[model samples]
Target: LGNTIVFPYSYKSSYKSNLLGSSTSPIQDVNMEEEFELKDGDVVTEVVDGIPTIIFFDQVHKYIERRMAKTIIMKLLGRSIGFNVLLKKITSLWCPRSPIQLMDLENDYYLIRFNSEDDYNKVVFGGPWVIFGQYLTVRLWSKDFSTSQSKVDTQLVWVRLPGLPEGFYSDFLIRAIGQLLGQVVKLDAHTNSARKGRFARLVVLIDLKKPLMSKIKINGRIQRIKYKSLPIICFSVWHVWT
Candidate 1:
């Protein structure tokens, strides 16, 4: 049984009888015991309802550490997208160092594995990605992730404050203005340094269920808000359409 992968099983006194099945083979019985022996912290037990529950802690840890570190879980909000289409679009957009593996999960969720950590970080921290006029919500993969229970209502969107006063470029002031739109996630380097005067750019986590703010008033002056890759919205009916 050397180098053979043994599956986890419950320990019982009749385990030898079950494996032998009336055959009196001492060697076979010894091999069976060796195969199922709990050794080297390979298996951990927890008492549940007066029964020991076996946990393959080492196997699970290795799987997650090697496989899931550069993996991300994502889902397209308010729409169902095909696997091939999503793969094609995101591959082209991300331009990863190596080809990515895309797997479709339960519900509308998708799992993406990247070969490079740089690619993973870029996609995770990247803008509220928009595909086919719909927002793509992205999150890091966790061991206890559930497709049905995971719901996304907010996205990190880039908002441009046009004609923002030069004095408002300070980090504190910009963040304060960003609160009017949504939770401030980050500020563009150029915007924070005041190198770009056209508009102040910052990333905000905006709620998708609410109407997006088109303009904001500052010091009794109207400042128009520009959203990047935003879906079409009908102001008359206050309805947003993808």
Candidate 2:
């Protein structure tokens, strides 16, 4: 779908991952060390349900989305190409995806959804929602896979954004990895904790920001990670049953 223009950016060099799923949210410290602040690769790992924890990234990266705004959605059938520049430049905000949107539930609580009757009377703007069974779920899912009496039903849920300010994603290229498949892929990170020495551990159940929807898996786990600049919220590993 992104056939219009190609960016002069390289995906590999601009990012790097760690071999261990360690805490990546760089601990804020003024006198800690410059090497720790600017150095890339912060690993975050955790254990859950007797299974090795997975690594995921919920970075509040101040992403500057520069794109050639299209005037029309059509093929090159000798049609006049209208020039469209970027519109609605929002700064210091949140960025959602074209599918599901990040929303504010109330106070410090936020949820994701495609649609919601519970929010029927609630005033919501610039968000995403969809129909799910009898109720609307933020992590929207498709119809049940079972039509038989013995079959079971399931759906993929949209992932939730971090506790970062919703304003950080104000109209950014929004994308939601539902809770059902919260981790779009797997990767690794290099982490060092007082309990665990500096080492690389394979990270599982990992997902990236919208731009990095591509999944990576190997050796029953993944290593190396490039995270976005986001405020720290949680430091536990998340596992989404595949």
Candidate 3:
């Protein structure tokens, strides 16, 4: 339903028809290597309208888990926010030539499909990313992604801290937090004057050499870190094998 925020995996088709379009044509089955094959590069091709069509190249969808609406709203405002906000943010990315398919699995994960490979690449390669005031942790969705070890050398982690004590901004504090967590990528701080004194807010996006499941508390205030993702593998295959 249009109003539903979460649903079981079986609902994907019906949901797609209503929200995206009714373009679920079936592809003829094709054979794959009897044994599992490790492939290089991230893209696949299909024959559509007598032309070769390039697709996401990756079998699974990649997205930012910590940037999802529910988890982010809970971590930042400490409450659940409406799904419409998330939809609006995603749709605003661009006006597409064809409807882009999006589904929030409610596992702090989302899946997106674009009609054009160009649009998909723009999203995948574009930099300086943020969603609803939080830094995004992007990844490809796959069963093996979570456990893959040959990922890029550095992965950026987004963090937000509220209710900092007055005059708490200092290099020492930033470096200390990074040391406690991972390498520092970017830092953001906002200061506002209050009747009593000035209070400050801080946000940090760090580069993690590896995935860490640690939490940090600064001056009794717990900071929510938004950096966790699965492994990514790239390969090019025929659509019939999808």
Candidate 4:
């Protein structure tokens, strides 16, 4: 009922009486009858710029508030998976503590509502989630989301600097090297402590359209780069797979 304007009986009577006083009322009774015969529960819409726009009152906010913390939107990049298949695969992969609800949205997008906040957080922070060899992009739901124009251009990926010298494990040096691939998001715990000598792991935000860097020259020596959970591409048919 917040921010919703309700006309009481007196107000409606007063308005009708005031209209009767005028010989030529701008708003006629017939027009009023046609427009204001509102039901107890009806979705209200008004014309705005020649387009019908829904009028959401405080009640809408209440509904949104209930689900805001536990709702997320997801889209699979470069591929479309059946709803049943995707649901089954994701349910098994995520294994949420409580049940989850999935709703199909426009443009291969899906809405997920989790019963528990812990499940929501796990899904939100757990990926670079991949399904059917395609990246499943997960994002917190927003009011301004538009499926038609939205595009998945960037993604968080774990990159490995294999055979890197132990001396280069310093925070400053590792971050500097990580820049060669993309924006360095964070260093893996073991990599930060240099406990894992085999390779240094860093989470990087990379552009999907750009060709991934295979190697970088540091001090005139080449260092090989490896990506975890990267999709494999078949050169013959240009099909990507896990």
Candidate 5:
């Protein structure tokens, strides 16, 4: 393996096989010494009990994915917060050797995975994890883990262009917003039915070069910007569990 990705929620294995013997999956035992010839860099599988078990012999670390959690759902509730910052905080506490993978189901809700069950326990049961002072609810994931990673998109900050003047085309709107709110990585426009067909009520999705506060200037006037998540919690200490 290039580098071992450690997950606290991983399964422990026995000498007879590299997989957990008590796992719910059906597996059959095999006699590696007599069944077949093994080498340093080959992959083989045998039914143990009723479940299929794979063994990579001396190089199991390189070929097997042992650092991920299946059926281990970690639902989170800090979407109105910065994704990168939140990810950094959680990773710093868990400190997994492999790149941590997370999926943004929608809004601030996310599905996070750890390298081991211990890390999951630490985060879920470690008590009162407050990120940016917003209480984080951690729990076991119940959904399928095979969701394609491509569903992940940029964590966008939605800005309400309340007073956009008439004739504000896409180019001009993007330029105007960029000048006020900082650089825009990606810009998109949407119309709401609640606006009653008024162009001034359009919403713009902005992927900022950096995160910003809740206020910005538009047409030289300070305007409060609404985002997908604007929690009422105040900033507080960031607790770590290492």
Candidate 6:
């Protein structure tokens, strides 16, 4: 935990909502798992449709613990039919169209891997500091994804640290931008100054709000791609202050 910042598990949702229906958020127990990289102090929250699915004690709601959220969602789904009934729903996390591919345990499950770095950059805010840019992502995870190991069949957020040096940039940025799309989104994307010799432009997005569109973050540098749109918001922010 020295150079590696300790993002605690407190950020994990304390409750969950059955997003399937009820017109409100549900309550759930944060299913702690070995895969949880979140430490014991990291501030986190789980919410849906504006209502926090779990109680939180963080400075702000930013990254959406993809695995945690997925678990909560799974609980929600399971609640509908009771936890004992896996039925064919276990595969929904893999193929949405034909998630029900099998009933037995062999093809009965799937893995949850969140590595859609390209997808996150395209839709919401974008970032990458290297001049030519070899690796531009910070964190990526998946919910019911396809992996080589036994399919987790649950949400899992993975980290993809930027190619930049430590402590220069990403200080003010959320750990995982894509995970916290909707409910509320904010970021403080920044880059290591070109003169710093860090040779990396840092983009830290400080998320301070709630869900925008599922897991989209909104901040000054957010893309108009959504990258393109950031300028518009910054322009507006500048005008209001002036």
Clashes of 1: 0
State, as a TM-score between 0 and 1, how close model 2 is to the true structure: 0.16
Choose 1 or 5, whichever is better by TM-score: 1
**Residue range 1-242, candidate 6, lDDT tens digits:** 00100011112111122222123211222122223245556655667898887553442233445333331111121112322233223322122221111111122221122223333342233322111212211222333333342322221122222333344344334334433432113333333222343323323332313122212224443322132122112422221110
Predicted model with the maximum lDDT: 1
lDDT of 4 by residue, 1-242 (tens): 00111111111123444334343432232123222333445457789999989876665655656535567777887888776677778877888766565656677777776666788767865676878777887766767667674565455667899999999988889999999888886788899899999999987876656767778899999999888745553323433331
TM-score winner between 3 and 5, please give it. Answer: 3
Ranking by TM-score: 1, 4, 3, 5, 6, 2
Residue 169 Cα positional deviation in candidate 2, in Å, after optimal superposition? 28
lDDT minimum window of 10 residues, candidate 4: 1-10
Per-residue error at 9 for model 6, in Å?
A: 34
lDDT of each: 0.68, 0.22, 0.39, 0.66, 0.42, 0.27
TM-score of each: 0.57, 0.16, 0.32, 0.55, 0.29, 0.19
Using lDDT as the measure, name the better of candidate 5 and candidate 6.
5
Listing every candidate in turn, what is its Cα RMSD in Å to the true structure after a full C-alpha superposition? 12.5, 23.3, 16.2, 15.1, 15.8, 17.9
- Candidate 1 residue-wise lDDT, 1-242, digit = tens: 01111111122223345335435523234223222334667777789999979788776567556656777777887888876677667876777765455666677788776656677768876755878877777766767677775565455667899889899998889999999988896799999999999999998877767777888899899999998744455544444442
List runs of model 6 lying over 4 Å from the truth.
Answer: 1-115, 127-201, 206-228, 231-242
For model 6 the TM-score comes to: 0.19
Best by TM-score: 1
* Cα lDDT tens digits for candidate 5, 36-56: 335745778889999999866
Off by over 4 Å in 2: 1-105, 108-181, 185-217, 220-222, 233-242
Name the lDDT of candidate 1.
Answer: 0.68
Task: Give the local distance difference test score of model 6.
Answer: 0.27
